[model samples]
Target: MKKDDQTVTEATALHSFDAMLTTYERWAQPCSQTFSRAALDGAALPVGATILDVCAGMGALAVPAAELGHRGWAIDVSPGMIERAAERLKPHAGWSTEVMDALDLHFGDNEFDAAFSVLGVVYFGPETGTALEQMVRVVRPGGVISVVNWAEPLGATFFIPVSRAVDRFDDPEVGKFVAPLTEFLEGPQLERALSGAGCVDVRSESVSGHFAVPSAEIFMEELDSVFQVLPQYRAAIAKDRDRFRDILVEEVLLMASKELPPARANIAYGRVPTPQETVGSSGLATS
Candidate 1:
Protein backbone atom coordinates (compact mmCIF):
# COMPACT_ATOMS: atom_id res chain seq x y z
CA MET A 1 0.00 0.00 0.00
CA LYS A 2 1.13 3.53 -0.69
CA LYS A 3 2.12 5.61 2.30
CA ASP A 4 -0.80 7.95 1.64
CA ASP A 5 -3.28 5.12 1.46
CA GLN A 6 -1.90 3.70 4.71
CA THR A 7 -2.39 7.04 6.36
CA VAL A 8 -5.97 7.27 5.14
CA THR A 9 -6.76 3.73 6.25
CA GLU A 10 -5.32 4.40 9.69
CA ALA A 11 -7.16 7.68 9.96
CA THR A 12 -10.42 6.14 8.88
CA ALA A 13 -10.05 3.32 11.40
CA LEU A 14 -9.09 5.74 14.14
CA HIS A 15 -12.15 7.88 13.50
CA SER A 16 -14.51 4.93 13.55
CA PHE A 17 -12.97 3.43 16.70
CA ASP A 18 -12.77 6.77 18.43
CA ALA A 19 -16.49 7.07 17.93
CA MET A 20 -16.97 3.56 19.30
CA LEU A 21 -14.80 3.88 22.41
CA THR A 22 -17.54 4.12 24.98
CA THR A 23 -20.16 1.80 23.48
CA TYR A 24 -18.31 -0.67 21.25
CA GLU A 25 -17.45 -3.25 23.87
CA ARG A 26 -20.91 -3.44 25.25
CA TRP A 27 -22.39 -3.66 21.80
CA ALA A 28 -19.86 -6.20 20.55
CA GLN A 29 -19.80 -8.33 23.69
CA PRO A 30 -21.05 -11.44 21.96
CA CYS A 31 -18.82 -11.52 18.88
CA SER A 32 -15.88 -10.10 20.79
CA GLN A 33 -16.04 -12.82 23.40
CA THR A 34 -16.31 -15.53 20.78
CA PHE A 35 -13.43 -14.19 18.65
CA SER A 36 -11.20 -13.61 21.66
CA ARG A 37 -11.87 -17.09 22.98
CA ALA A 38 -11.04 -18.69 19.68
CA ALA A 39 -7.86 -16.65 19.22
CA LEU A 40 -6.68 -17.39 22.76
CA ASP A 41 -7.50 -21.07 22.45
CA GLY A 42 -5.44 -21.32 19.30
CA ALA A 43 -2.67 -19.36 21.02
CA ALA A 44 -2.15 -21.90 23.85
CA LEU A 45 -0.04 -19.25 25.51
CA PRO A 46 2.22 -20.41 28.29
CA VAL A 47 1.95 -18.50 31.52
CA GLY A 48 4.32 -15.50 31.74
CA ALA A 49 5.23 -15.69 28.10
CA THR A 50 5.54 -12.36 26.30
CA ILE A 51 2.67 -11.99 23.86
CA LEU A 52 1.71 -9.34 21.32
CA ASP A 53 -1.90 -8.49 20.52
CA VAL A 54 -2.05 -6.63 17.25
CA CYS A 55 -5.13 -4.53 16.53
CA ALA A 56 -5.96 -5.21 20.12
CA GLY A 57 -9.27 -3.38 20.19
CA MET A 58 -10.12 -2.45 23.77
CA GLY A 59 -7.78 -5.21 24.95
CA ALA A 60 -10.23 -8.03 24.54
CA LEU A 61 -7.47 -10.65 24.18
CA ALA A 62 -4.84 -8.57 25.98
CA VAL A 63 -6.82 -8.32 29.20
CA PRO A 64 -7.40 -12.05 29.25
CA ALA A 65 -3.76 -12.76 28.50
CA ALA A 66 -2.77 -10.56 31.40
CA GLU A 67 -5.23 -12.35 33.66
CA LEU A 68 -3.64 -15.60 32.57
CA GLY A 69 -0.20 -14.30 33.70
CA HIS A 70 1.16 -13.45 30.25
CA ARG A 71 3.17 -10.31 29.71
CA GLY A 72 0.95 -8.64 27.17
CA TRP A 73 1.71 -5.86 24.69
CA ALA A 74 -1.30 -4.63 22.74
CA ILE A 75 -1.43 -2.22 19.84
CA ASP A 76 -4.14 -0.46 17.88
CA VAL A 77 -4.39 2.52 15.54
CA SER A 78 -6.94 4.36 17.64
CA PRO A 79 -5.76 6.40 20.61
CA GLY A 80 -9.20 5.96 22.10
CA MET A 81 -8.88 2.20 21.89
CA ILE A 82 -5.42 2.28 23.44
CA GLU A 83 -6.64 4.49 26.24
CA ARG A 84 -9.54 2.22 27.05
CA ALA A 85 -7.32 -0.84 26.73
CA ALA A 86 -4.85 0.67 29.15
CA GLU A 87 -7.65 1.23 31.62
CA ARG A 88 -8.89 -2.33 31.25
CA LEU A 89 -5.34 -3.70 31.69
CA LYS A 90 -4.26 -1.25 34.40
CA PRO A 91 -4.78 -3.75 37.19
CA HIS A 92 -2.27 -6.11 35.62
CA ALA A 93 1.33 -5.02 35.95
CA GLY A 94 2.46 -7.14 33.01
CA TRP A 95 0.15 -5.48 30.51
CA SER A 96 0.77 -2.44 28.30
CA THR A 97 -0.86 -0.80 25.27
CA GLU A 98 0.34 1.28 22.33
CA VAL A 99 -1.19 3.17 19.43
CA MET A 100 0.58 1.95 16.31
CA ASP A 101 0.06 0.74 12.78
CA ALA A 102 -0.11 -3.02 12.40
CA LEU A 103 1.41 -2.95 8.92
CA ASP A 104 4.54 -1.33 10.32
CA LEU A 105 5.05 -2.81 13.78
CA HIS A 106 8.07 -1.08 15.34
CA PHE A 107 9.28 -3.93 17.50
CA GLY A 108 12.46 -5.76 16.60
CA ASP A 109 12.41 -9.24 15.10
CA ASN A 110 11.81 -12.11 17.52
CA GLU A 111 10.56 -9.73 20.17
CA PHE A 112 7.51 -11.73 21.24
CA ASP A 113 6.97 -15.30 22.39
CA ALA A 114 3.61 -15.41 20.69
CA ALA A 115 1.50 -13.03 18.61
CA PHE A 116 -2.09 -12.83 17.47
CA SER A 117 -4.67 -10.54 15.92
CA VAL A 118 -8.40 -11.00 16.31
CA LEU A 119 -10.14 -9.85 13.14
CA GLY A 120 -7.48 -7.22 12.62
CA VAL A 121 -5.38 -7.36 9.48
CA VAL A 122 -8.03 -8.92 7.28
CA TYR A 123 -9.60 -5.54 6.75
CA PHE A 124 -6.48 -3.95 5.30
CA GLY A 125 -7.91 -4.38 1.80
CA PRO A 126 -4.97 -5.73 -0.25
CA GLU A 127 -2.35 -5.00 2.37
CA THR A 128 -3.35 -7.83 4.67
CA GLY A 129 -0.23 -9.84 3.88
CA THR A 130 2.02 -6.88 4.64
CA ALA A 131 0.49 -6.57 8.10
CA LEU A 132 0.73 -10.30 8.72
CA GLU A 133 4.40 -10.29 7.78
CA GLN A 134 5.06 -7.58 10.31
CA MET A 135 3.24 -9.69 12.90
CA VAL A 136 5.33 -12.77 12.08
CA ARG A 137 8.50 -10.68 12.25
CA VAL A 138 7.96 -9.94 15.93
CA VAL A 139 7.46 -13.52 17.09
CA ARG A 140 10.35 -15.62 18.37
CA PRO A 141 11.16 -18.69 16.33
CA GLY A 142 8.81 -21.53 17.29
CA GLY A 143 6.42 -19.08 18.90
CA VAL A 144 2.81 -19.32 17.81
CA ILE A 145 0.90 -16.75 15.73
CA SER A 146 -2.87 -16.86 15.40
CA VAL A 147 -5.52 -14.88 13.55
CA VAL A 148 -9.32 -14.86 13.26
CA ASN A 149 -11.30 -13.92 10.15
CA TRP A 150 -14.95 -14.26 9.22
CA ALA A 151 -16.28 -17.10 7.12
CA GLU A 152 -17.78 -16.05 3.77
CA PRO A 153 -21.40 -17.15 3.63
CA LEU A 154 -22.18 -16.35 7.22
CA GLY A 155 -20.26 -13.09 7.08
CA ALA A 156 -22.13 -12.03 3.96
CA THR A 157 -25.40 -12.82 5.62
CA PHE A 158 -24.49 -10.84 8.71
CA PHE A 159 -23.51 -7.77 6.72
CA ILE A 160 -26.14 -8.00 4.02
CA PRO A 161 -28.01 -5.02 5.40
CA VAL A 162 -24.94 -2.81 5.38
CA SER A 163 -24.00 -3.91 1.87
CA ARG A 164 -27.45 -3.33 0.52
CA ALA A 165 -27.74 0.02 2.21
CA VAL A 166 -24.41 1.15 0.84
CA ASP A 167 -25.27 0.04 -2.64
CA ARG A 168 -28.55 1.82 -2.57
CA PHE A 169 -27.53 5.04 -0.84
CA ASP A 170 -23.81 5.65 -1.22
CA ASP A 171 -22.33 7.10 -4.39
CA PRO A 172 -20.84 4.41 -6.60
CA GLU A 173 -17.65 6.42 -7.04
CA VAL A 174 -16.94 6.59 -3.34
CA GLY A 175 -14.43 4.13 -1.94
CA LYS A 176 -15.31 1.46 0.63
CA PHE A 177 -14.37 2.23 4.17
CA VAL A 178 -14.09 -1.43 5.03
CA ALA A 179 -12.94 -4.07 2.60
CA PRO A 180 -15.21 -6.93 1.66
CA LEU A 181 -15.08 -9.71 4.26
CA THR A 182 -14.82 -12.29 1.50
CA GLU A 183 -11.36 -10.98 0.67
CA PHE A 184 -10.04 -13.06 3.56
CA LEU A 185 -12.84 -15.62 3.92
CA GLU A 186 -11.50 -18.88 2.54
CA GLY A 187 -9.48 -21.12 4.88
CA PRO A 188 -6.80 -21.89 2.32
CA GLN A 189 -6.42 -18.21 1.49
CA LEU A 190 -5.77 -17.55 5.17
CA GLU A 191 -3.31 -20.44 5.29
CA ARG A 192 -1.51 -19.05 2.28
CA ALA A 193 -1.23 -15.67 3.97
CA LEU A 194 0.43 -17.28 6.97
CA SER A 195 2.79 -19.39 4.88
CA GLY A 196 3.67 -16.41 2.73
CA ALA A 197 4.50 -14.52 5.89
CA GLY A 198 7.15 -17.20 6.66
CA CYS A 199 5.19 -18.92 9.42
CA VAL A 200 5.47 -22.70 9.59
CA ASP A 201 3.16 -25.54 10.52
CA VAL A 202 0.15 -23.44 9.58
CA ARG A 203 -3.30 -24.74 10.49
CA SER A 204 -6.84 -23.41 10.38
CA GLU A 205 -10.15 -24.33 11.95
CA SER A 206 -13.74 -23.11 11.83
CA VAL A 207 -15.45 -21.64 14.89
CA SER A 208 -19.22 -21.31 14.65
CA GLY A 209 -21.13 -19.33 17.27
CA HIS A 210 -24.09 -17.01 17.81
CA PHE A 211 -24.91 -13.82 19.61
CA ALA A 212 -28.11 -13.77 21.64
CA VAL A 213 -29.06 -10.42 20.22
CA PRO A 214 -31.91 -8.82 22.17
CA SER A 215 -33.74 -7.06 19.38
CA ALA A 216 -33.28 -5.93 15.80
CA GLU A 217 -33.52 -2.31 16.81
CA ILE A 218 -30.70 -2.70 19.33
CA PHE A 219 -28.64 -4.75 16.96
CA MET A 220 -28.95 -2.18 14.21
CA GLU A 221 -27.96 0.59 16.56
CA GLU A 222 -24.81 -1.20 17.69
CA LEU A 223 -23.80 -2.39 14.25
CA ASP A 224 -24.25 1.06 12.77
CA SER A 225 -22.07 2.61 15.44
CA VAL A 226 -19.11 0.53 14.30
CA PHE A 227 -18.69 2.03 10.83
CA GLN A 228 -20.28 5.46 10.85
CA VAL A 229 -16.86 6.98 10.32
CA LEU A 230 -16.59 5.56 6.86
CA PRO A 231 -16.65 8.50 4.46
CA GLN A 232 -19.22 6.91 2.23
CA TYR A 233 -21.37 5.78 5.12
CA ARG A 234 -21.22 9.21 6.63
CA ALA A 235 -22.01 10.73 3.26
CA ALA A 236 -25.04 8.53 2.84
CA ILE A 237 -26.17 9.39 6.34
CA ALA A 238 -25.77 13.05 5.61
CA LYS A 239 -27.77 12.70 2.44
CA ASP A 240 -30.74 11.00 4.09
CA ARG A 241 -30.05 10.00 7.65
CA ASP A 242 -33.54 8.87 8.64
CA ARG A 243 -34.17 6.89 5.49
CA PHE A 244 -30.76 5.24 5.74
CA ARG A 245 -31.43 4.29 9.32
CA ASP A 246 -34.89 3.03 8.52
CA ILE A 247 -33.70 0.93 5.60
CA LEU A 248 -30.87 -0.57 7.59
CA VAL A 249 -33.14 -1.26 10.54
CA GLU A 250 -35.69 -2.97 8.34
CA GLU A 251 -33.03 -5.12 6.67
CA VAL A 252 -31.41 -6.08 9.96
CA LEU A 253 -34.81 -7.00 11.40
CA LEU A 254 -35.51 -9.20 8.43
CA MET A 255 -32.43 -11.24 9.26
CA ALA A 256 -33.05 -11.15 13.00
CA SER A 257 -36.65 -12.24 12.54
CA LYS A 258 -35.44 -15.43 10.95
CA GLU A 259 -33.53 -16.18 14.16
CA LEU A 260 -30.73 -17.76 12.17
CA PRO A 261 -28.07 -19.75 13.98
CA PRO A 262 -24.71 -18.16 14.61
CA ALA A 263 -22.41 -17.94 11.64
CA ARG A 264 -18.93 -19.50 11.61
CA ALA A 265 -15.54 -17.80 11.67
CA ASN A 266 -12.28 -19.26 10.44
CA ILE A 267 -9.41 -19.20 12.91
CA ALA A 268 -5.83 -19.86 11.77
CA TYR A 269 -2.73 -20.72 13.80
CA GLY A 270 0.92 -21.10 12.80
CA ARG A 271 4.39 -21.26 14.33
CA VAL A 272 7.55 -19.31 13.57
CA PRO A 273 10.25 -21.78 12.68
CA THR A 274 13.17 -22.32 15.01
CA PRO A 275 16.69 -21.47 13.78
CA GLN A 276 17.73 -25.11 13.51
CA GLU A 277 14.51 -26.06 11.80
CA THR A 278 14.91 -23.24 9.31
CA VAL A 279 18.49 -24.26 8.55
CA GLY A 280 17.60 -27.93 8.14
CA SER A 281 14.68 -27.19 5.87
CA SER A 282 16.33 -24.61 3.67
CA GLY A 283 20.08 -24.64 4.49
CA LEU A 284 19.76 -21.11 5.89
CA ALA A 285 21.59 -20.14 9.07
CA THR A 286 20.51 -17.58 11.61
CA SER A 287 22.54 -14.56 12.53
Candidate 2:
Protein backbone atom coordinates (compact mmCIF):
# COMPACT_ATOMS: atom_id res chain seq x y z
CA MET A 1 0.00 0.00 0.00
CA LYS A 2 1.07 3.58 -0.60
CA LYS A 3 2.02 5.76 2.37
CA ASP A 4 -1.26 7.63 2.73
CA ASP A 5 -3.23 4.55 1.85
CA GLN A 6 -1.31 2.51 4.43
CA THR A 7 -1.90 5.00 7.23
CA VAL A 8 -5.57 5.34 6.29
CA THR A 9 -5.88 1.57 6.24
CA GLU A 10 -4.11 1.25 9.57
CA ALA A 11 -6.35 3.89 11.08
CA THR A 12 -9.35 1.88 9.96
CA ALA A 13 -7.88 -1.26 11.50
CA LEU A 14 -7.30 0.53 14.78
CA HIS A 15 -10.93 1.72 14.88
CA SER A 16 -12.62 -1.52 13.84
CA PHE A 17 -12.53 -4.11 16.64
CA ASP A 18 -15.30 -6.70 16.26
CA ALA A 19 -13.19 -9.75 15.46
CA MET A 20 -10.64 -9.26 18.22
CA LEU A 21 -12.61 -8.84 21.44
CA THR A 22 -11.85 -12.15 23.15
CA THR A 23 -8.14 -11.66 22.83
CA TYR A 24 -8.20 -7.92 23.58
CA GLU A 25 -10.26 -8.08 26.76
CA ARG A 26 -8.30 -10.92 28.29
CA TRP A 27 -4.91 -9.23 28.11
CA ALA A 28 -6.09 -5.60 28.25
CA GLN A 29 -8.43 -5.68 31.23
CA PRO A 30 -5.89 -6.60 33.90
CA CYS A 31 -3.91 -3.41 33.43
CA SER A 32 -6.60 -1.20 31.89
CA GLN A 33 -8.68 -1.52 35.05
CA THR A 34 -5.82 -1.70 37.51
CA PHE A 35 -4.46 1.60 36.24
CA SER A 36 -7.88 3.14 35.66
CA ARG A 37 -9.10 2.81 39.26
CA ALA A 38 -5.64 3.76 40.48
CA ALA A 39 -5.74 6.99 38.49
CA LEU A 40 -9.23 7.75 39.82
CA ASP A 41 -8.00 7.16 43.34
CA GLY A 42 -5.31 9.73 42.65
CA ALA A 43 -7.93 12.23 41.45
CA ALA A 44 -10.36 11.30 44.22
CA LEU A 45 -13.63 11.64 42.25
CA PRO A 46 -16.79 11.21 44.32
CA VAL A 47 -18.20 7.69 44.21
CA GLY A 48 -21.80 8.67 43.48
CA ALA A 49 -20.98 11.04 40.65
CA THR A 50 -21.98 10.46 37.02
CA ILE A 51 -19.07 9.11 34.95
CA LEU A 52 -18.26 8.76 31.28
CA ASP A 53 -16.20 5.83 30.04
CA VAL A 54 -14.71 6.71 26.69
CA CYS A 55 -13.23 4.01 24.48
CA ALA A 56 -14.61 1.69 27.07
CA GLY A 57 -14.00 -1.73 25.53
CA MET A 58 -16.32 -4.41 26.86
CA GLY A 59 -17.13 -2.10 29.78
CA ALA A 60 -14.14 -3.23 31.83
CA LEU A 61 -14.17 -0.14 33.98
CA ALA A 62 -17.84 0.62 33.25
CA VAL A 63 -19.13 -2.47 35.04
CA PRO A 64 -17.01 -1.72 38.08
CA ALA A 65 -18.09 1.90 38.13
CA ALA A 66 -21.75 0.89 37.96
CA GLU A 67 -21.19 -1.59 40.74
CA LEU A 68 -19.77 1.27 42.73
CA GLY A 69 -23.10 3.13 42.29
CA HIS A 70 -21.97 5.61 39.66
CA ARG A 71 -24.14 6.24 36.60
CA GLY A 72 -21.95 5.26 33.68
CA TRP A 73 -22.08 5.72 29.93
CA ALA A 74 -19.68 3.56 27.95
CA ILE A 75 -18.78 4.61 24.40
CA ASP A 76 -16.88 2.76 21.70
CA VAL A 77 -16.61 3.00 17.92
CA SER A 78 -17.36 -0.69 17.41
CA PRO A 79 -20.92 -1.98 17.35
CA GLY A 80 -19.56 -5.33 18.42
CA MET A 81 -17.85 -3.67 21.33
CA ILE A 82 -21.07 -1.87 22.20
CA GLU A 83 -23.02 -5.11 22.05
CA ARG A 84 -20.43 -6.83 24.18
CA ALA A 85 -20.42 -3.99 26.68
CA ALA A 86 -24.20 -4.01 26.81
CA GLU A 87 -24.20 -7.74 27.43
CA ARG A 88 -21.59 -7.40 30.13
CA LEU A 89 -23.38 -4.54 31.85
CA LYS A 90 -26.98 -5.71 31.21
CA PRO A 91 -27.35 -7.51 34.50
CA HIS A 92 -26.39 -4.29 36.26
CA ALA A 93 -28.34 -1.07 36.38
CA GLY A 94 -27.04 2.51 36.06
CA TRP A 95 -24.82 1.67 33.11
CA SER A 96 -25.42 1.91 29.33
CA THR A 97 -23.40 1.40 26.17
CA GLU A 98 -23.22 3.44 22.95
CA VAL A 99 -21.35 2.91 19.69
CA MET A 100 -20.26 6.53 19.60
CA ASP A 101 -16.63 7.66 19.45
CA ALA A 102 -14.28 9.36 21.88
CA LEU A 103 -13.12 12.07 19.49
CA ASP A 104 -16.65 13.14 18.69
CA LEU A 105 -18.42 12.33 21.96
CA HIS A 106 -22.13 13.19 21.70
CA PHE A 107 -22.60 14.58 25.20
CA GLY A 108 -23.19 18.28 25.88
CA ASP A 109 -20.61 20.51 27.51
CA ASN A 110 -20.00 19.81 31.19
CA GLU A 111 -22.57 17.06 30.90
CA PHE A 112 -20.70 14.66 33.13
CA ASP A 113 -19.12 14.85 36.55
CA ALA A 114 -16.22 12.53 35.75
CA ALA A 115 -14.81 11.13 32.48
CA PHE A 116 -12.32 8.29 32.50
CA SER A 117 -10.50 6.28 29.85
CA VAL A 118 -8.68 2.96 30.10
CA LEU A 119 -6.25 2.11 27.35
CA GLY A 120 -8.16 4.75 25.38
CA VAL A 121 -7.45 8.28 24.11
CA VAL A 122 -3.95 7.34 22.96
CA TYR A 123 -4.56 6.75 19.26
CA PHE A 124 -5.54 10.16 17.89
CA GLY A 125 -2.70 10.02 15.32
CA PRO A 126 -2.33 13.61 14.13
CA GLU A 127 -5.45 14.76 15.96
CA THR A 128 -4.50 13.76 19.52
CA GLY A 129 -4.53 17.27 20.90
CA THR A 130 -8.01 17.95 19.54
CA ALA A 131 -9.46 14.68 20.85
CA LEU A 132 -8.05 15.29 24.34
CA GLU A 133 -9.55 18.77 24.25
CA GLN A 134 -12.84 17.11 23.36
CA MET A 135 -12.55 14.82 26.43
CA VAL A 136 -12.02 17.90 28.58
CA ARG A 137 -14.95 19.68 26.92
CA VAL A 138 -17.56 17.15 28.05
CA VAL A 139 -16.60 17.38 31.72
CA ARG A 140 -18.06 19.88 34.15
CA PRO A 141 -15.74 22.27 35.91
CA GLY A 142 -14.00 20.53 38.84
CA GLY A 143 -14.79 17.15 37.31
CA VAL A 144 -12.00 14.66 36.77
CA ILE A 145 -10.46 13.40 33.49
CA SER A 146 -8.25 10.38 33.87
CA VAL A 147 -6.43 8.30 31.24
CA VAL A 148 -4.24 5.18 31.21
CA ASN A 149 -2.14 4.38 28.13
CA TRP A 150 0.56 1.90 27.16
CA ALA A 151 4.06 3.30 27.23
CA GLU A 152 6.04 2.91 24.00
CA PRO A 153 9.38 1.45 22.86
CA LEU A 154 7.95 -1.31 24.99
CA GLY A 155 10.30 -3.44 27.05
CA ALA A 156 11.53 -6.71 25.58
CA THR A 157 8.62 -8.82 26.79
CA PHE A 158 6.01 -6.52 25.26
CA PHE A 159 8.07 -4.81 22.58
CA ILE A 160 9.23 -8.04 20.94
CA PRO A 161 5.90 -8.86 19.35
CA VAL A 162 5.10 -5.21 18.73
CA SER A 163 8.45 -4.64 17.04
CA ARG A 164 8.08 -7.64 14.77
CA ALA A 165 4.53 -6.74 13.95
CA VAL A 166 5.52 -3.17 13.21
CA ASP A 167 8.44 -4.37 11.11
CA ARG A 168 6.03 -6.50 9.08
CA PHE A 169 4.65 -3.30 7.66
CA ASP A 170 4.87 -3.36 3.87
CA ASP A 171 5.18 0.36 3.44
CA PRO A 172 8.46 1.95 4.50
CA GLU A 173 7.35 5.48 3.72
CA VAL A 174 5.24 5.96 6.82
CA GLY A 175 7.70 7.19 9.44
CA LYS A 176 5.63 7.76 12.55
CA PHE A 177 4.32 4.78 14.50
CA VAL A 178 0.98 3.45 13.26
CA ALA A 179 -0.35 4.22 16.75
CA PRO A 180 1.15 5.38 20.09
CA LEU A 181 4.76 4.40 19.27
CA THR A 182 6.99 6.71 21.29
CA GLU A 183 4.12 9.09 22.06
CA PHE A 184 3.95 7.76 25.63
CA LEU A 185 4.01 11.13 27.38
CA GLU A 186 5.47 11.58 30.87
CA GLY A 187 6.29 15.25 31.62
CA PRO A 188 5.67 18.16 29.24
CA GLN A 189 3.43 16.30 26.77
CA LEU A 190 1.09 15.44 29.61
CA GLU A 191 1.15 19.03 30.86
CA ARG A 192 0.47 20.44 27.42
CA ALA A 193 -2.29 18.01 26.49
CA LEU A 194 -4.06 18.09 29.85
CA SER A 195 -3.44 21.62 31.09
CA GLY A 196 -3.65 22.92 27.56
CA ALA A 197 -7.15 21.50 27.46
CA GLY A 198 -7.90 23.54 30.61
CA CYS A 199 -7.31 20.65 33.01
CA VAL A 200 -5.70 21.34 36.38
CA ASP A 201 -4.15 19.46 39.29
CA VAL A 202 -2.70 16.83 37.00
CA ARG A 203 -0.96 14.01 38.86
CA SER A 204 0.59 10.99 37.13
CA GLU A 205 2.47 7.78 37.89
CA SER A 206 4.76 5.24 36.17
CA VAL A 207 3.08 1.96 37.06
CA SER A 208 3.95 -1.46 35.56
CA GLY A 209 2.62 -5.08 35.59
CA HIS A 210 3.66 -8.59 34.60
CA PHE A 211 0.97 -10.67 32.87
CA ALA A 212 1.44 -14.33 33.85
CA VAL A 213 0.80 -16.84 31.08
CA PRO A 214 1.08 -20.56 30.42
CA SER A 215 3.40 -19.80 27.52
CA ALA A 216 4.33 -17.20 24.93
CA GLU A 217 1.93 -18.91 22.54
CA ILE A 218 -0.83 -17.97 24.95
CA PHE A 219 0.33 -14.40 25.00
CA MET A 220 0.82 -13.97 21.23
CA GLU A 221 -2.49 -15.65 20.55
CA GLU A 222 -4.12 -12.81 22.48
CA LEU A 223 -2.83 -10.17 20.05
CA ASP A 224 -4.80 -11.28 16.99
CA SER A 225 -7.33 -8.45 17.27
CA VAL A 226 -4.74 -5.69 17.35
CA PHE A 227 -2.87 -7.45 14.55
CA GLN A 228 -6.05 -7.42 12.48
CA VAL A 229 -6.38 -3.70 13.16
CA LEU A 230 -2.83 -3.06 12.06
CA PRO A 231 -3.17 -2.88 8.28
CA GLN A 232 0.56 -3.07 7.74
CA TYR A 233 0.84 -6.40 9.51
CA ARG A 234 -2.53 -7.70 8.32
CA ALA A 235 -0.72 -8.79 5.16
CA ALA A 236 2.24 -9.97 7.23
CA ILE A 237 4.24 -13.14 6.69
CA ALA A 238 3.46 -16.36 8.46
CA LYS A 239 7.11 -16.55 9.40
CA ASP A 240 6.76 -13.08 10.91
CA ARG A 241 3.90 -14.33 13.03
CA ASP A 242 6.08 -17.15 14.32
CA ARG A 243 8.84 -14.70 15.03
CA PHE A 244 6.46 -12.48 16.97
CA ARG A 245 5.24 -15.43 18.99
CA ASP A 246 8.73 -16.59 19.72
CA ILE A 247 9.98 -13.14 20.66
CA LEU A 248 7.13 -12.60 23.05
CA VAL A 249 7.85 -15.95 24.63
CA GLU A 250 11.49 -15.12 25.13
CA GLU A 251 10.62 -11.68 26.49
CA VAL A 252 7.95 -13.10 28.72
CA LEU A 253 10.39 -15.53 30.28
CA LEU A 254 12.84 -12.66 30.76
CA MET A 255 10.29 -10.26 32.16
CA ALA A 256 8.75 -12.97 34.31
CA SER A 257 12.02 -12.99 36.17
CA LYS A 258 11.40 -9.34 37.03
CA GLU A 259 7.60 -9.69 36.64
CA LEU A 260 5.50 -9.32 33.43
CA PRO A 261 3.55 -6.16 33.98
CA PRO A 262 1.70 -5.15 30.79
CA ALA A 263 4.18 -2.27 30.53
CA ARG A 264 1.78 0.63 31.15
CA ALA A 265 2.75 4.23 30.41
CA ASN A 266 0.89 6.39 32.88
CA ILE A 267 -2.43 7.08 34.55
CA ALA A 268 -3.04 10.81 34.54
CA TYR A 269 -5.81 12.52 36.50
CA GLY A 270 -6.60 16.19 36.10
CA ARG A 271 -9.62 18.41 36.65
CA VAL A 272 -11.06 21.01 34.32
CA PRO A 273 -9.87 24.36 35.50
CA THR A 274 -12.68 26.63 36.70
CA PRO A 275 -13.56 29.48 34.34
CA GLN A 276 -12.07 31.90 36.81
CA GLU A 277 -8.79 30.08 36.17
CA THR A 278 -6.19 31.66 33.94
CA VAL A 279 -5.25 30.47 30.46
CA GLY A 280 -1.52 30.80 30.09
CA SER A 281 0.38 31.38 26.83
CA SER A 282 1.09 27.65 26.50
CA GLY A 283 -2.60 26.69 26.55
CA LEU A 284 -2.33 25.86 30.28
CA ALA A 285 -4.51 27.65 32.83
CA THR A 286 -2.93 29.15 35.93
CA SER A 287 -5.37 29.63 38.75
By lDDT, the best candidate is 1
Runs off by more than 4 Å, candidate 1: 1-8, 153-158, 164-179, 214-223, 229-236, 279-287
Mark the regions of model 2 whose C-alpha exceeds 4 Å error after superposition.
1-16, 155-180, 214-222, 229-262, 284-287
Give the per-residue lDDT digits (tens) of candidate 1, residues 80-189: 98998899898999787899999889899999998888878877867777888898889988899888888863252446567666666656554444544446687777
| Per-residue lDDT of 225 in model 1 | 73
Error of 2 at 280 (Å): 2.5
Model 1 error, position 98 (Å): 1.2
- Alpha carbon deviation, residue 26, candidate 2 (Å): 1.9
Model 2 agreement with the true structure over 67-93: per-residue lDDT tens digits? 777787999877877788899888877
What lDDT does each candidate get? 0.75, 0.66
RMSD to true structure for each model, in Å: 4.1, 4.4
